[model samples]
Target: MGRGYLTKEMKILVTGGAGFIGSSFVRCFMEKRQNPVVTLDSLTYAGNMANLEAVLGLPRHTFVKGDICDPSAVDFAMKGVGAVVHFAAETHVDRSIDDSGIFLRTNVVGTGVLLDAARRHNVKKFVHVSTDEVYGAVLEGYSTEGGHLHPNSPYSASKAASDLLALSYHATYGLPVVVTRCSNNFGPYQFPEKLIPLFISNALEDKPLPVYGDGLYVRDWIYVDDHSRAVDRVLWDGRAGEVYNIGGTKDKANLEITDFILNKLGKPASLKKHVQDRPGHDRRYAMDSSKIEKELGWRAECNFEEALAQTIEWYRSNQGWWRTIKSGEYRNYYEKFFAGRLAGSSAGSVN
Candidate 1:
């Protein structure tokens, strides 16, 4: 609720700012506030410039094409930044299953690189954006911020390590670190590999919606914009060396989400395919978000159904955006069109 820490001229360094949630935060921040932003992203398969088209050519937004694992890129992006919102990481469970090494490198070691840069640069605030999977499966009650971390998959284990490392920076060196663990995020521009987007796009194409196992694995879902707002709150007012849980207050099983998407798209149940569940799939994820609500006065503001409908409409409207990624054409398009021009340009050229 307080804006004491951020000034009008302060520039925020948002890592992974070209990705889904990061782009949402950038758009939200630009609309509500006047702070300049420097976005550092490697432009990976999931990170797309099309996702950030809204703010790409704006005067206040700067996009840097670079990886978090690169110290030079991190340092270049950290310059003159008042706050650091760390969102750069490899965040796919299936991909991690295929190759866990990249997850460890990008999530753990890359976080260390950013934290050290924040420390050396003396940034005003360092917010480490993390996930609820760090608590593994919350079978019964909610997992609080202080709950034990039981990361089952390699991706979550890497995130858990990054969370601890980010907090350790505050504990050991007083670097002003705040960590936020959020539930499943769904909204526009999400890479189709994620469950909600994947199902939506698949149903749209009249393809099979692969429902894992019995299709009953539950997760707490939050709209991406609400999660962005919560992160903005933490970036400005959160207590250092502390963790906050952010949730949507909507817990639905996998089947519920799948059925909703199929029905919403006017598709039939026969399109549902029962696939073997991935290894170590967490049964359910629930979080207690009371800390952020009570202290920061932030709560999830959007209804799940309404937000989900809006997201479906977004996909419908932006077929070219998701279709290119689905067909593997976006990579070539990106390389030929955007990547060559923006790579290491540093002027934030939108052309």
Candidate 2:
């Protein structure tokens, strides 16, 4: 077995650690290992400091507020780091469609900045966290790591470009970059903008659950913790310059998930409002995870319905956490984006 990098005692950096998935990784790593972790995040609309409340005060955990595109910030956070798990980027497809400049600058340019810093620091490993959306819609079968990338959205396009750039660093400069693209992630502390949490919160409030098009779009759902564990495997034992696909193996349609959330919350089917679909919406996304499972002996452990039930419970118990988010800028975006479609369905705005 090839030990790609990092001893048990070395320090690691987790970019965007204050966000949903990154925070999960930080908490998971801090609890299970002795290594110190340095977190860097700029606290965007989606990035919340409260997400890291579990491990903020831990002795080995350090938080830095900075952007990845800033070379100075990247350098400061790169010091004494043996590995980097980069999760920082603009991830929302709707927002990317609204404007793609930020995605390109942050996802592509920022990744370049981080890769250069890692090379200069001689970091033992660079784990480039990515999404399966880079493969676009897998209309049939599953997309393997070696499959061709056919990104359909501005967000996925930026990620595809960044993935190539990360691999280029490994090929050109021997940066030990290993990219892992995972399916849709859902769990506690996720922003309400995503499908699972969005519908869960909306169901809780009796707000109309906006269903895009026919709501039959399919996506492979992986619990955020499971995805975090896969990244951990890749970070430690994954061979350099390789791409691994992580999937939950639980594929569900949008309306099927909506029905589950409505039933779970005791809400009626009346709240589901069919809305015009967004442009370039992929019909389905599926990925083959045999590489990660066979190579690193890692597979998603959480059952979809069970993990989703737990996720709903988390949102139910933590209303204040999500309320604060929905009451802020997200509310404005929601109203502007969905108000036209969601109007006359009991509420005029998300608030």
Clashes of each: 0, 0
* Model 1 C-alpha lDDT per residue in residues 25-105, reported as the tens digit of each score: 999988999889999998889988888889878889888877788888788888899998989899999999999999999
Off by over 4 Å in 1: 1-4, 339-351
- Candidate 2 lDDT over residue span 1-351, tens digit each: 236658987889899887899999999988888898999886678888678878876778887767899898888788899999999999899999999999999999999999999999999899999999999998899999999999999999999999999999999998899999999999999988988899999999989999999999999999999999999999889999999999999999999999999988899999999999999999999999999999999989998899998999999999988998988854464335343543342211111
The TM-score that candidate 2 achieves is 0.93
Off by over 4 Å in 2: 329-351
lDDT of each: 0.90, 0.89
Candidate No. with top lDDT:
1
Q: After superposition, how far is residue 48 of candidate 2 from its true place, in Å?
A: 0.8
Question: What TM-score goes with each of the models?
Answer: 0.96, 0.93
Looking at model 1, which ten-residue stretch has the lowest summed lDDT? Answer: 342-351
Q: Model 2 shows how many backbone clashes? A: 0
